[model samples]
Target: MNRPHYILQPVSPLFITLSLTGAFMLNLLPWGRWIGAPDFVALVLVFWGIHQPRKVGIGIAFFMGLMMDVHDSTLLGENALAYTMLSYLAIMIHRRVLWFPVMTQAVHVFPLLVFTQAIQVLVRFIVSGRFPGWLHFIESFVAIALWPAITWLLLAPQRRAVDRDHTRPI
Candidate 1:
């Protein structure tokens, strides 16, 4: 099967901010406490890191992570550390990740999401000496499942129209 390649337009900083904010808002919902609840912030951070590394780098991830730490009331800097590392790794692999289709990209992303959660769990275990159990890792799987849809949604604003009008001259 052949896929039409789209020449994406330049991404707006405002859109990036909005998407990150929206993901943060999604995390604030009541269902966040449930097991296997996907980390929206992590997902979006990775997305932007992979697609626009210069625009969304370690600093942004760290800030978002700090926000999550405050919200969760967990050990300070826990999320920040995880997000920072995640962003770094994403940025390092961004070029290679972009060559794949969205579905394949999800395959590449699964490890990153799992690593993020593992860092959180490791921090919690070190601080409290309690394990959250294997179920905690399910969130990564859920986030991976959402990867393709999120890719489409986030890229929609940057995608140029497929049809060209003859009245317009290049």
Candidate 2:
């Protein structure tokens, strides 16, 4: 139950499109410390990077992050910077990392999230002259723990694509 596997397939562009939209919705949802955590954008990005590397990449991540930054009004390029780093990691590791069990890659990806956020924090600190609350880092923990399940949900399209033998070369 702790481990995850990437069974590659072609997923509907519709699902991918919806997933991207859903991520933004989730990102915008208001939440307290006791409820859900940060946006699942990176989680979706990671799954696509592993399962559909050709479809989702740094450009998408950067754009999504940029949108998020604009939506949240945090600083220009803050989320974009973090998202770009996450995208870079996913693309770079997609080939070999895809072979690893889902949980294994999640473990590795946890730091990429943290590191990216760390950069975001550093940049924020430089501009704002203060740090975000400790709970802000909590998103990393939530992301790693939630990776497998989120990955599973996005896998639907992959399976649908594969079922129809529409897998494109990654």
Candidate 3:
């Protein structure tokens, strides 16, 4: 006799959209003069890109970057470029990342988050000749620290009773 295979329910598009929207709303909130506020939008994009690559690909990341650019009043393509590249990288490593438990995954994800933030900083420096300073990179650390919490929050709702294979027939 074969053991039962448990499967999670398919995630709805509504949930994904709401998660991204919530990230955007968080990004919109002013966090005062602190220079290390995490990039919430990028965090959400990375999360979805890693977990749901088929649903959130480079195009969506680029579009979200554009939205962020508009929101932050930055150069039009700056974030688009960074986000597209980040999504590409996330897709490349999604398989490996997914195999790890969430805590271990954060260790793997930390570098990717730093790389994306580095790209953003580089682009801004190139465009304006202004260095965003060391504090800017600190946000990546904050993002890394928040990874487990964010993953828990986003995945909590979807982590329902795992269903047995019903399609296997009566």
- Candidate 3 residue lDDT tens string, 41-159: 88888898898999999999999999988988999988898889888998999999987777888888888888888898898888889997888888888888899999988877665
Instruction: Please report the TM-score between candidate 1 and the true structure.
Output: 0.95
Per-model TM values vs. the true structure: 0.95, 0.82, 0.88
Off by over 4 Å in 3: 1-6, 162-170
For model 1, how many clashes? 0
Question: How accurate locally, in lDDT, is each candidate?
Answer: 0.95, 0.76, 0.85
TM-score of 2: 0.82
162 Cα displacement, candidate 1 (Å): 11
lDDT of 1 by residue, 1-170 (tens): 57877778899999999999999999999999998899999999999999999999999999999999999999999999999999999999999999999999999999999999999999999999999999999999999999999999999988855567778442
**TM-score winner:** 1
Clashes by residue pair, model 2:
10-161, 11-157
